[model samples]
Target: MYPRLFTAAAFCLIAVASSKAEEDSHAIFRRAEAPKEVRAAVTCDEADDIITRDAFAGGWLWQSKCPSNHANFIKAQIFSRDKNGKDAKLIRFPVPRGTPLEEISNVEFFPATREFNSLFVNPEDESVCRTEARWIAQNALKPKLVFWRETKDCDGKKGWRVLKGRK
Candidate 1:
């Protein structure tokens, strides 16, 4: 009788321990569910995905995509005469909200100048190309936020030639 009782007690103890382990596992799973901190990290990563590095428009232009519903498409460029001496803001502009950045588009850069251009196409119809896209100037001239040096002979007194110009 004592042997039978001991066996029954041992079986009950094992069953209870197994049930407790299962509950602990469930608690761990509940704690691992995605929290608010994880969501903010995903939101910040999205901005870095907006642009692509593949060159277009005669291999001198880079393509950038604007956020789907933003009011402006902001692009910033840094330029320098030397290969790595210093660089300054070549141009910065905000293409209109519907700038056609999503479609197959191309940008043009003047070979030795700070002038840059982009061909905006109709979002609904790709065939209908628009030569002129009104871009809001972030800065009328190359911003002086970078290292300052003597003005080159090519540049007039304005530090850098800017084109808020139409394509």
Candidate 2:
């Protein structure tokens, strides 16, 4: 019985490893990971990287997003440079994760400048049937987390329209 159990466990581990490899290869699917753990779902070129202008400050914000499918977490890699324009530091901010299509979230930078972390829209908790997203504005002097106005679709999809860009 012990040998059989060991064999079964080994098989399960191999199967899990193979499945994870498959997900890694596929473009749409990403190996499920918890929030704050960084993983790339798509290639760097496919990532919607917002390059900040030199007028304000030279830096870039790469929001890890697929052109087609949206991931659970707002895995954004931000870089805020010094005046010299050298590689200052890489500030990676991962927003709270949400359920796959049922509960969606989005993040938009204010002024679209070379600054890090403006605002983010996400459900307070993914497990519950919440309507509004927790709109957090870090750019303001006193950062506040508020709920966005809710909108219901014909298909019973509750979504919050925070920023006026992207789906």
Candidate 3:
């Protein structure tokens, strides 16, 4: 009787431990099965140029306009694969402020010049400022403005519109 009782207790403990382990494994698998979001703002065709496998290389260029300034510009170049398989983009301008805020009045893309130009109007006062032509490398994901400068005439902060690549 005593031996039978001991064996039953041991079996019960083993069964409980096995059940806990299975539950833990299921939890871990569930977490691992979740999907991840990819960060690609523009399609391949939207890029300035797309290179096939072994054609040239995978990379991209990004550009952003400065606030209130017509001539100043920011640009960056991003590579598809790093030396160690790490994908990264190099930022040319290191502005603390992210992207300028302006209501884009007009946008123009010059194929000959390979430049993107636009005119932005302040959302608050409607003050107009021209964004000079700037060239961005092809393949960049989403180039965000990191810094900005305010024009003497347009000193107020307002929203900005992106006019690049707009038809």
lDDT of each: 0.32, 0.35, 0.32
Instruction: Provide the global lDDT of candidate 2 against the true structure.
Output: 0.35
lDDT of 3 by residue, 56-115 (tens): 134222222223334332221223343221443333322233553222223443323333
Distance from true position, residue 63, model 2, in Å? 3.4
- Sorted by TM-score (best first), the order is 2, 1, 3
Worst 10 residues of 2 by lDDT: 33-42
The prediction achieving the highest TM-score against the true structure is 2
Instruction: Give per-model CA RMSD.
Output: 22.4, 17.4, 18.3
User: What stretches of model 1 exceed 4 Å from their correct place?
Assistant: 1-76, 88-90, 94-105, 112-114, 124-167
Q: Give one digit per residue, the lDDT tens place, for model 2 in 71-125.
A: 2333333233332223323333223343222112344444333223332233443
Report the Cα lDDT for candidate 1: 0.32
Best by lDDT: 2
**Model 1 C-alpha lDDT per residue in residues 103-151, reported as the tens digit of each score:** 2124444433334454333334333323333322223232212211222
Clashes of each: 0, 0, 13
Count: clashes, candidate 2: 0
